[model samples]
Target: MRSEMPYANISGTAVAIPVTGGSLAALVRLPTQLPAPTVICCHGLLSSKDSSKFAAIVEDLCQAGFATVRFDFSGCGESRSASEASLLGTRLRDLLRVMAFVQEQDWNNGQLGLMGCSLGGYLALLGAADSSSVGVKALVCWATPFDLAGIRTALESGNLPHAMATASRQLGEPQDLAGLPPLSRVLVVHGQQDATVGWRAAIEIYRRMADPKELLLFEEADHRFVDPACRNMAIQASTDWFRKHLAGSP
Candidate 1:
């Protein structure tokens, strides 16, 4: 079941989507017109649908006449479970469920794009690559870690335990990225100064991805794009990418 309410003057809707554990809270920003191609915006770890960055991006996307759906992963924000209990796999499942819900929405135009930040970005790529039937038309990831081995190294060297290595072994690498028919119409953005998920990870993703893809690296930006200019640039780029790929040429 789902419940919705109007969102201020933005022509947006506050939505509640049913999932495995409970509800996944979301905000859907729509263009003035109907049947707009939609972008599913996924927030990073420790963030929710109302994050300032996501809000700004949604505004930009809506202004460009593209509908946007920003949602919290399973356990975060107003969702049912506690954040600590949410695992990587659980988050992926939650996103896939959200994808299904988006497909069923009346405003969606059958074209779907995914835009995500940090851990959310990683999951977006994982879903697009691994799930052949996911139906995503385009993808954008910011500060995402592409290689699990690199993540394991960064974590262990930063005084954290070697949990990522174990995750790699248990979850296994995404098979889609390993060979042909790699994800298409992909865009990867990374901050050169991003210490969390180094820029090299973005390169790794770009290298593995099939053609019709792009990579953008901002030298002055940090992991979260602390610089306002950098953040705006990233948002605009994402909006343009979705417009071109999802909405077709102007």
Candidate 2:
């Protein structure tokens, strides 16, 4: 028999967050306590809040006493807008709006945290790195790409905005790194055998961040952590990191 442990009370509500083009379809999970710390979950390219990996992680976070919000980027899930493709800046703006929306809720303490996977991870790091005013206190990134050039090359063959195509060339181009605010604490996780994006990107991100950071490389896992054991480890690590950093903060 497995050992039993008490989990924090959790509840979820479906809500639409207003954005420029349309409302973002999102699910907000709360830990039954008011003014609690919250973590916004960002999904990878072509993924949404309902993605299996994200859903599992969100559940773990909620049980660990953190409020979690997961939403679909424009054009991806139930959101109303339809962009031919998601731009880096657009994703950043959406996250900022989510931050604003969360702040309005009386139940939130305004102590924010972010967790992202793959492309989402890249956005999380970018958003938190420059988030002096947004109040992002901690970040968790899994298999994030450090550069946008590769993404552009892979997706640009399809329909994409001219400006977005041009912008991708500039993002993650070293100059972008200069503008990113220093992060207080960070956790970077990557699969050792990831084929989509190399584990080296994790190292690059670690190099860019300040102290009080950690990196975990899992062997025998792919980009999505296809293996159940790897996935479990990833969820546990992410939940623990957020708990350690986000606890006791108003």
Candidate 3:
């Protein structure tokens, strides 16, 4: 069941999703129409559900007559933090839990989409690849890495948050994108000047995906996409992709 408590000072309803250890903090924004297609937004390693990027996308999606949900992964944002031993595996579980929760909501029309950034994007791929992610029709990945090696390097070098560095140690083997089955319609967006993850990762992801895939690269953008023009382009592109693929939910 969804929480009834009123969330203060937010445009959407605040939800507290029960998990094993605690709960995940999430915000749900609904369109004027009922039973609309739903999209879940996932933030990067250190970012939260309050990301400006997510806010922009959610606004556009709501206006397009789609519902959107943005949640904080365990140990990030408003969600309860985990122990030092907690790793990507824990975060994956959190995502799966959110997916399950969304499916149970009456506001969802059974058509689910995912939009993720950086590490969150990688997690979205893993969730969609999982056998349990039913009703997921499409996904969009932004500045996502193809493998865990670069993440491991970033974690070790203190480039990323220190909390994730300890978690990286437990991420035994590197994941293989080739092993992922063609789960759904995929859109890969990357910045040509992305020094953090590099544009090559986008190419690799695009190549490994099946048909119904697209790759968009911006020459002046970086991993964070700090520039307003670049960010708007990515947001518009993503919204267009979701609108096209998640047209009719049965």
- The TM-scores of all predictions, comma-separated, are 0.83, 0.85, 0.90
lDDT (10s digit) by residue, model 3, range 1-250? 7444432223888888888778889999988787789899988888999988889888888888888889998878888745334467777888888999988888778899999999889889888888776767889999998887765665667666644624445653335466767655899999999988888999888888877889999999999888899999999999899999985534
The residue-level lDDT of candidate 1 at 33 comes to 80
- Candidate 2, residues 148-238: lDDT per residue as tens digits? 6666665555544333323333332332343555575899999989999899888888787887789999988899998999999989998
Q: Is candidate 1 or candidate 2 better by TM-score?
A: 2
Candidate lDDT values, in order: 0.76, 0.77, 0.82
Q: Which ten residues in a row have the lowest lDDT in candidate 2?
A: 1-10
For candidate 1, lDDT tens digit of each residue in 1-250?
Answer: 3334343347467777777646788888888787788889988766788889998988999989888889877646776632222255667777887888878877777888999998889888877755544688899999987655554344445433322222232333342234524788899999999987789888888888777899999999999998999999999999889888879922
Per TM-score, the best of the predicted structures is 3
TM-score for candidate 3 = 0.90
Q: What's model 2's lDDT at 135?
A: 78
Q: Tell me the spans in candidate 1 whose CA falls farther than 4 Å from its real position.
A: 1-11, 81-86, 148-181
Ranking by lDDT: 3, 2, 1
Clashes of each: 0, 2, 0
Candidate 3 — which residues are off by over 4 angstroms? 2-10, 81-86, 154-162, 165-169, 172-176
